[model samples]
Target: MINDNVFNGTFQNLSQKNMPFEQVFLNILQFMEKDPTGNFKLMFGTDSQVYSRETKFITGIVIQQERKGVWACFRKVILPRKMENLHERISYETTLTEEVVSLFTEDKKEQLIQIVLPNIYKGASLTIEGHIDIGSGERNKTRIFVKEMISRMNSIGLKAKIKPDSFVASCYANRFTK
Candidate 1:
């Protein structure tokens, strides 16, 4: 069985503290309700860092209304020992992101989608994306695993994004993984 404690652990942003997963879901709904006419994107991503003794992983969940604003939060998971393998670390990050995404059940996603359906004619819509930290750049050590990671995200029905464009992972979650 999945551990509820880990999945429902506190998520925090600059303005919110120790919020349970349910509160985070409510906040996202409220944000969308405030401006249903705006285009929305719900994004999930993860980044990790290997310290001397352990590996720190930060998974970020963001809800963005195009050109307006965003509501985001992150949760951290740390492994007892450092994960030194490039492929293993990248794979673990993806797994963490997927675990969090699984918490947004079909019903929850439908609720978020329903909020924007009425505004669809006005060019408003909602899209879900999974951002993987790996990239295809020649010099990027994570290049080789991009396809595999993207495939993993796609398997769960998320539009997959990577590197430069995946700010949620390469930028946001990355900040806390340090």
Candidate 2:
């Protein structure tokens, strides 16, 4: 189960209502089943925006079904006070993404692995990608942590991504960070 309340947002064809993480996750599973032949990529990531009074963190879960469109849900957390350093801030963002991925790939995997579904999840492999907010773009200060962050994720057996390739963090999750 997810740790925070999920906001389906414009994705999932649901209204902007908060729901239990488990229910939201289960709903996603059922939704994916609607198209058995669709190629789905599940990505998890987090992004943060620092304000004078607080830091807003948005963790997003994206299910991209190629050609069929996307379904996403996000959870937000606000911490009092801002992080002054870029490295530390990026680390925090990556950690949050890792945490959310862990909740699904490790925790929920064990809990839901028993469900005999017709999808690849039943007897095939399901790869989870972790998207980081750090980018290698020249104007981006977070580039320095790119290698370190990607290494951290790889060491945990999770494929890492950043910037342009990390739409889950840079685009989807970022949109809700405000």
Candidate 3:
């Protein structure tokens, strides 16, 4: 129930169209330009289209909430022209938890395509299309979620890139100077 009102504003990066996983990830990451803190969780999908012999990738972000009740937000993509403070301070924390990476699982990836992607495209809004189901409490759910996250990470060799991070740090360090 978070960010649902503005969810339609977000859309997939056009450059990642029909690209391989490596390129897709690279492009999507840049397209996101997300603050590197506990601000958000990213979700993406690569959908195959046989007719054009291409794959389309769509990426969406859900804001991480810290309120008493569970909450998530789909943040609308802000057009660059609308950005009044490009040099504003953004979170620099790079620490990622298992739950963070697990959000990139295959199923979640697919769901992004089937469910979230269309919603994002329809109206230029960032929308969270799901509910927080904590009916049973966080006792066992947290543990189980962690286990599944670990398994998903094992399934996909996900890790931070030392080379790319350095390059981006250097490049974007001056992006807002103008």
Q: Give candidate 1's whole-model lDDT.
A: 0.91
On residues 1-178, what C-alpha lDDT tens digit does candidate 3 reach at each position?
2133322433222232233334434443443333222222332111111113221111222233212111211212222223222111111011112223344567645543343344443332222222111112355332233333333334444322222222212222112121
Candidate 1 has which clashing residue pairs, if any?
none
Candidate 1 vs candidate 3: the TM-score winner is 1
Considering lDDT, where higher is better, how would the candidates rank from best to worst? 1, 2, 3
**Best candidate, TM-score-wise?**
1
User: What are the models' TM-scores?
Assistant: 0.94, 0.79, 0.21
Q: Model 1 reaches what TM-score against the true structure? A: 0.94
Q: How would you order the candidates by TM-score, starting with the best?
A: 1, 2, 3
Please provide, for model 2 over 5-122, each residue's C-alpha lDDT reduced to its tens digit, 9 standing for 90 to 100. 3323222223645655676677667756667555667788888999998788788887776777777887776667787788887888778777666556565664333332355653
Residues 1-50, candidate 1, lDDT per residue (tens digit)?
23554344778887888888999999999999999989999999999999
Model 2 deviation from native, Cα RMSD in Å: 4.8
- In model 1, the runs with Cα more than 4 Å from the true position are 1-8
